[model samples]
Target: MPGRAPAAPRCAALVGPYLSGKTALLESLLFATGAISRKGNAKEGTTVSDSSPEAKARKMSVEMSTASADYLGETWTFIDCPGSVELAQEARNALLVCDVAVVVAEPVVDKALTLGPLFKFLDDNQIPHILFINKMDQAEHTVREILEALQAVSSRPLVLRQVPIRVPGKDGDDVTGYVDLISERAYKYHPGQESDLIKMPEEILPREQEARTAMLEKLADFDDHLMEELLSDAVPPKEEIYQLLSKDLADDLIVPVMLGAAEKDAGVHRLLKALRHDVPGPEVVAKRLGLDGKDASAVIFKTSNQQHSGKLSLARIFGGKIADGATLNGQRIAGVLKMKGHAGEKVPAGNPGEVVALGRLEQAKTGDVLTASGKTPSGYKWPDPLRPLFALAIDVENRNDEVKLTAALAKLCEDDPSLSFGHDPDTHELLLYGQGEVHLNIAFDRLKNRFNLPVKHRRPSISYRETIRGQLKQHARFKRQSGGHGQFADVHVEIWPVQRGTGFEFHDRVVGGSVPRTFIGSVEEGIRDYLVRGPLGFPVVDVAAALFDGQYHSVDSSDMAFKTAARMAMQEAMPKCNPVLLEPIYAVEVAAPNEFTARCHNLITGRRGQILNFGAKDGWPGWDMVEALLPQSELHDMIIELRSLTLGVGNFAYRFDHLQELTGRLADKVVEQRQAAAAH
Candidate 1:
């Protein structure tokens, strides 16, 4: 067993808010592990992760990228995920298969609130994570102040492992080194080189002791033995402290806070060492995923379309080994690849806990669990994609490429579960839905750049229905006489308003058979056709029509004649009925931080929304839910406005509640717009 191959590799995902320097931190990690010879700067578009054309153009990560490293002869994979809230689906999905997540953040107090959603997700899933405070040299706040600000958003206890050492001779107070609280040892940082251990400064002794005591006390709360030792005034050993910290982190009971400046590669070496020692291995993560470690099974978490090679499915093997040409989910593995950024190398096999890209697995998709026997694992719960909050109506610019565009869009959705597209039944426009405007923009960019499908994007149309405000009855006869044949049919019908949401109804009251039995169905059909577009230039709803009296000529009164007569009667009656426009009202529920509740209420009311209720949102603490009835037309840009007011964390879900009458100037304007559109 001494010379046996190392166990399956462990994976770590880097996640945080936008512009938090996660990509730079990933580069530092790869360099520290000796995976890359030179570090790439994110701003210059030289990083291996953000290599896509869209990412380079925007200088931000729009999707997840995988890179593997071998540190100390053991394989470890680091997945760099996008930090933009609009692109959070990539982070969420990547975090699922990772053993631990590094939540990169700046040393700012107010910025802590932006991490609430990410913290809540990690805690809810019971995933182990650590906080890495980046850009320490440029920090504007003290470490203690930053930690206090972050603790408010997370449920887990925060354990500070290191305290920064300020260099005295700098133009301003700057962090040039750190003191390890656990070991009580100090070191001076050297950029792009190994840090030198230095004598513990005499002035900072009291501060280090205070921080160490606080960290120990937080850990003692969960350990009875440690608590007893602390109560007895006994000092715990360094090994015991580290073991407890690792155990607590793996259990999701605590989060260890580390410091680093990724741009200079300072403090990154220590961070890498910490990860190599404390991160969970394949066995622990496999058990957490509810999979037996003996079987050869894997779950596909990402899919990529390569220009030279076709489709590649990146999956994490949970058990046993998957070799080249192995069949899983009834599809043969055409190849096995080991990926580092956009470059991939062919590998003979993928073992448990390793992330590999299986070549040409066309049938496989994200969130799919596959086994060598082609049977899926039972009771495995995958994370559901978040509901789309933004939409755009889009079409191919070149009509000849419409079919190609459709095929490419399908592939895009398959790659990103959060991206979806459909044809609006009423508007007849192809609507693409996503998390936010930026999310949709990236989707369209991919259409043009990746698939070469030029597209035109615009806002979608609103659905408005019309109904009658008053009732009337009129009679008309369809009479046409030619030299040889004649078309003559007469009918009497009663039209009246119905309750809202009752929809269209047709009735027959011809007891004397004035309208023949065979012609009754045709009469109803004609009335239904007339309702499709009423005099108000919209679909008719909440109305009824009854055929009370009608006469048909025996010679020419066929179904066609009766149908034409019924159409004439409805056309003569509806204008007298006083038609009115009805706009859809939606029941909306908005969720936001407590501080933003008032702003949300104002947004709803400004859009003519009626407040129903407000209360604390269930399950999410320090958050409130506000319920209101809003017009559908007012909701098109509601998500954009809500996010701007709530630090990009607020969101809402809505459904059609009822149709309200649109009258006065608004109704007149709607009718005019409808007529103009119809003319076009």
Candidate 2:
């Protein structure tokens, strides 16, 4: 009987921290596979990935790019995801549909902490991944040291698959090639070409043996037969070792480590071979995602609005073939296009395991699972978008473009679920929320370049409230003689401060018909309207008002008269009530490596935050989670500074905790600014 054929199509995602060369690796992969005639340089703005104008200008990826290639007569799709922490959601969405993730990283020991969150996400989802240590040519430390640093952040064991063969060069030691531990073969790397096989170097024998032994021991931990052979001091067959490695990787029990300099195309072919042989097929992933054996089911991983082509939904077919004009989720597929970066070619149908863009999926969205029966799969779960950490109050430059801006924002938010926009209820300002300053700037760039909407933004206003401290009673009368039914009303109202967070309350203590029963409600309405903008120029809370005494003329005392009198009484009484400002406080939890836990505490304290408690983050070894109560005003730029101090690995989640009194010079300054803004 003939050996079973390889899986037809497989998808892999390239993900890592910023500046780790994922795009470079993508370019090398496409070039080595002959998908492109010549490799394009990222810095030169010629690469297939990162072809967006914004990415070219920044020399970094701001969005995910997909390309398909054929290696060894098997189809493969590679998604090159943005490496910036601000754009991590793009990577997360892409990883969910891929067969494996190529976690590209540098050999720098200090920057190894940056991979902590990515590693945790992958392992938590039980997604199979390979650690491709890129930029090996510029490595400053030994592979062992780099691996040790990386192993600290990863929950799974790091199985070293290749050991670098260093040679003397113009700049100290250089990685000329790598030794394959499983194959027991040596190769010499040639720039822009495949590595050439060579005899095992005599000096590399000891290191190679040690690494290979370690690899076998890790595999033996998952294989009892291999453990028995090791105990007997017997060498396992190469085929048996390869099988065990593949099984362990597919089970997400080990992270196979590979070394390469993607910019130079070294070790590219070997990585491709490993992907072709070891990575599981889409069926395996489908089963893992609870869609096994289902027919005509596909999951959309990305959604985009193109310049002229309209909306495109990129989906990975899980069970059945999707053809042009096929109905999915009650929407007819207008077209099926096989995507290669920004360009695509129309295809008649998309088969299982292939990533294809379905045109005009206006009703479909990212993370939606589509089926031919027009029914959703039960108990299916997709990741919710990340909580927005930064915000900007935005306005359209051209007032005439306000309607256009709303439609454009809808499209943008659909493309990137992490982005959101809405009117702040307290301040009445249209605010845009995103990951950080850079992320929002990119959204602005898209609005201008893609949608032609020029927008202006500023730091969002804090939702500060005013409450009274002192209690007092005042009397006022409204008597207007306009010749016809002149208004006449008299009232004595008492206002008092309530406990914090008690909100507002109104009581009608009028007796003996002093104030008419019908006009009493009008008095409360007028007082409530005045509270909308209090004497301190903020919404008033935690206060109560009562209509204690009042006199009204039967003919002249209408609801309007009593309302006007109530307003006059409040205006004269509030200034003497001693109002104060209250700012919102949030309970924040910051996660970072334990080594930086002290710095995190200082960061919180420096920003007027009260540390609650900190301890080890569950399931995340060598990491700490610090809890604190932080003022909302201090969090506008906190993410930027936190990332700066923690090597871009720290992150935080927060929710409104309580309202605290604001005083001192800071409070004075806020009131001054409010008055100044009101004057304008």
Candidate 3:
């Protein structure tokens, strides 16, 4: 890969929905840039972005890939990101370091909704983005209709800057030409090449010229001089129209929509020109972050595990300057890397808006802000990960690998923010939570492939606890006659319920010199330990107990005798207060197509879910958010069924909602498990 990275590199991210041609677009870009000799298609399973075994097998992108290309005297750094919602974190992270977002969308209306969430994110971040209306070569709708569909859903103004030239007497199998609104000139395709050179077309001059005038009018609205010329019925100059675009684009005042065919690599060169000249960079982002451009500061975007490199923190400097081997945020990092998809090289220094990598940064975390020698670190917050949608218990395949499994899984989570890891305290299950079923499976596959950490996954157990709701008192006596001495201890206790979630409480009320002070402490300790598990074998909580009176044999009575007596008293008292099973409830929210909302509602109801409310949310196909209280036990199967019902289009997530009563068959299962665990 020598001489791979050309001197001037423009990094961009290829992002869109699954099967919307993201990988194919990357293949075309690679071939057109001469990085590869031949093009590979996603269906053919030979694209560079899908090079990973898992990706090739599944025919999807599992992570973001970086590649470099030399086009028109510029080295374009392209990152191909997955379109699946599960793997969108990789795409989002890629956007953080890059200056431009070339949003790819199809010509049809149905597939356009998938771009909703991505566009919202870019808009919120004020990222300079362009709309690439791909698949124009076989578009189902006319150019005007496609533009209208995009215009309706777009939050920002999407102005069309390129009009496709339909091939005359052709089956529309190819896009023969295009008109650039700014230049007011036609670009006719050159056979055997990806793009065409600018030349005025002879076949369609008047119509194209008229459309160009209209585009100038749109551009004129952003510029006073152009607006004045338009009012006077004078056509704005071509240079004047382009000059206004640079400012409007940087401000995100307008998003220029252009047509392209990724298969033919027709519009890629135009997109590259836009990136190098139209899009803004780190300076724009740094100013928004309140960072002084002269101050040294950078943000880590992605972290990867290497065989010997330890941890590679891929970052982009936002403000100031950074030199290789320089200290940042109290740790020394390896050299800076100027990234290409399949390759990268060490760099000596980087400035604001420069995409670079730090090798083996010990203390650096993704989204962490690092500053140069004298600069202050500030203003980079990581995107909040999507709520964990699916969870499964994990156990190491080999007992010897248990420690390594934990360490390796932790590293994997550190690399992807959407993942969460912890032990379910009530169930005592080691659970890993992620965005969805496919999300978790991909993560599992990566764990095995990348770090060789093998693990078995199962549905996590429901977390439960035991509590009492009444008051009762009882007496306990432990008397035994052994060889050394007879152990005798008698105790009277009162047990009552506190407010919910108060946990266990123990008190000593031995008054009037009834029980000795030394024995009283032992009684409390014994009761506390016994409260660890109740009659149903759940951690006993929200109950209070007091030792009212006791008698002990001075010669033989000791802590053990008192301990036994106290435990026996608890056994006789807690159940008398009517212990009940309390299960953890999750606040579940389901979003799906409106047609499936009824099915979702019925599904939630069947799962012992309480319908809290329902409403709409953004981006989903007529999305309905069903707010419900669902016990954690039934959630696993509910998710599986919901996905099946919607044909893998339904998505939902839940958090610890509240603890609710568990009085029926599910509670019976808890009791059974408790007995089995006790036997073991």
Candidate 4:
């Protein structure tokens, strides 16, 4: 018989809170599968997953790293997401491409305290996931103690799959000897030699026999054979137990807890073997994507710019084979490689159970579908990041770097969704916003280190507008004589105030064509262009201008002539109209801890905020959302104080409310600082 068709490549996302050993686990998995010569330590900056210079300097992952392993004749693609909430969207992207998730959780009481919201996120995604309590070697507590802590934060049933046989040390400390629940065998780790598995140590076997029986009873509840074997004194075959556990794990029926020292590879080889066998393959994930197993469709999970190769679209092949020279979305692509971190070999086979990179795919983006062009493929949409803190305004000092900066930032943003940069129209600042301060800092570092785009970060300037306090009539005449038909245009215009947000308005109030009809429109264009640089170095707004009178030379009064006159007239009239700075105000919604109400109230009042309402909120304990209209000028540094008062748990979101008047030194500062920046 012909070989059975392979299943879809299975995908699993690795995510957890900050510093939860996610990187270490990937390192251990890669090395144990013989994919690498030696495992790299995250602290030593030699880890395969976080090999970027930014990761090395910060000692944390700023973006998601995609890698694959082939073991037991099965291929598994895994995503290692940044642990910080700022970059947690990396995990979200990982989930989009995967059928299952591995939520790496530290099995410690204090560490498990913040897993409530994260648990809800995973549960909501409907991605069957297992909880791995990593770093078991250094943890002071036992596996059971960590399980109970997780049980308290989440309502999910904490099932025991493996219990570490603790061996006491001389200082009254304990080290894990073997997993007692998996089998009755005992494991002894020798310092220099490989581990030894022997017949059950008679003394310790009895000590864990009761717990072993309880664990088997739970497993038997799902597998009928185990239940029958339990009563009949016929022990269930180990293969049958593994099958049931694997099925339930894939189905999200029950989560199996596994323990291992991610650094030492203790219990790691067995864990990865099980994952390769049990984790849903790409074929299965394609089913989850609502695809029939023919033709290729894969989500672009990552995009990286390589030094030698321009752009590498690292993706998982969901259905069908992606061979060399296969057309994607009607575009013929070149080269595909099965990646093991930074090193990958050109592989012709892009099978269902594989994680490969389609190099130099021009049409691909982070979430783009790689299907035959014009085919509607079923896939989940990318999640929008909720970035609360904005930081890092980057622009290059070198003129050449400035030319490359936009393209470089685009590639970086394509790689990591949490990283974003653009120019603010009102402030004229190239603003970069991210999940937090550290996040954008790392992004800037990557831009400089990886692509050699040297950039710097500074505070984003507050965006404000300029409007008139009262109407004023001003006339400007431009008469120049240099050659034949010298430029000459004279105009009289009236300026009036509109509602704060009515924007800019222009009307033709002339008769008999005092100014030629052609020049009339040119006058309005000049006024709008002048608005970008207003009297106070801001965008001019909420003012109406009308052409009441003008004189023009038919030959001399060209569009350029009227444009120059219009600029001069507006410049003269703005200061006389009682020009005032219009600063942006945000409609803020602050969900803060109740005890910080007084502090928040005082803080907002100090920032010129007008509170609309304040009341209690549901679902969150001791929290209230204070709705207010606050000036945007007051918001740049507002989060720092808000977080300080709330002990780092409070959060808020806001949008543009309106533009209001700016008086006093705040108005003076806007002009003074703007002039200073222009000078620089």
Best by lDDT: 2
User: Order the candidates by lDDT, highest first — what do you get?
Assistant: 2, 1, 3, 4
Q: Write the per-residue lDDT of candidate 3 for residues 130-247, one digit (tens) a residue.
A: 8888887778787778767676556777878888777655564456768877766678755336465667666667767666676676677778888899889886666666667867
Off by over 4 Å in 3: 1-9, 43-45, 167-176, 188-194, 197-225, 319-324, 346-353, 379-387, 588-603, 614-626, 637-654, 673-680
lDDT of each: 0.88, 0.92, 0.76, 0.74
Report the C-alpha lDDT of model 1 over 1-680, residue by residue, as the tens digit: 01233445889999999988999998988888888999997779899899888899899999999999987678888999998888888998888888999999999998888989999999888789999999998898899899999998888998999999987555678898999988889988988876789999888898899999999999999999999999999999988898899889999999999998999988888887777777787666667666665553887889987556789999988877889999888999999998888789999998777899999999989988888777665656787898888898998999999888888888998899999999988778999999999999998898888888879999887789988878877787998888876888898998999999999899898888888889889999989888889998888899999998988888977777888888888888888888888999999999999999999999999999999999999988889999999998899888999999998899899888999988899889888988998899
Off by over 4 Å in 1: 1-7, 169-171, 294-296, 483-485
Sort by TM-score, best first.
2, 1, 3, 4
List TM-scores for all candidates, in order.
0.97, 0.99, 0.87, 0.80
lDDT of 2 by residue, 89-138 (tens): 89999999899999999999999999999999999888999999999999
- 13-106, model 4: which lDDT tens digit per residue? 7888888788888877777666667778788888877777778887888777777776656567777888876676677777767867777877
Residue 192, model 2: Cα distance from true site in angstroms? 2.6
Which window of 10 residues has the lowest lDDT sum in candidate 2? 1-10
- TM-score of structure candidate 3: 0.87
The alpha-carbon deviation from the true structure for residue 55 of candidate 2, after best TM-score superposition, in angstroms, is 0.8
Off by over 4 Å in 4: 1-9, 66-70, 113-118, 141-145, 152-156, 164-172, 177-247, 273-278, 372-374, 378-391, 473-493, 507-530, 546-573, 588-630, 634-653, 678-680
In candidate 2 the C-alpha lDDT for residue 539 amounts to 92
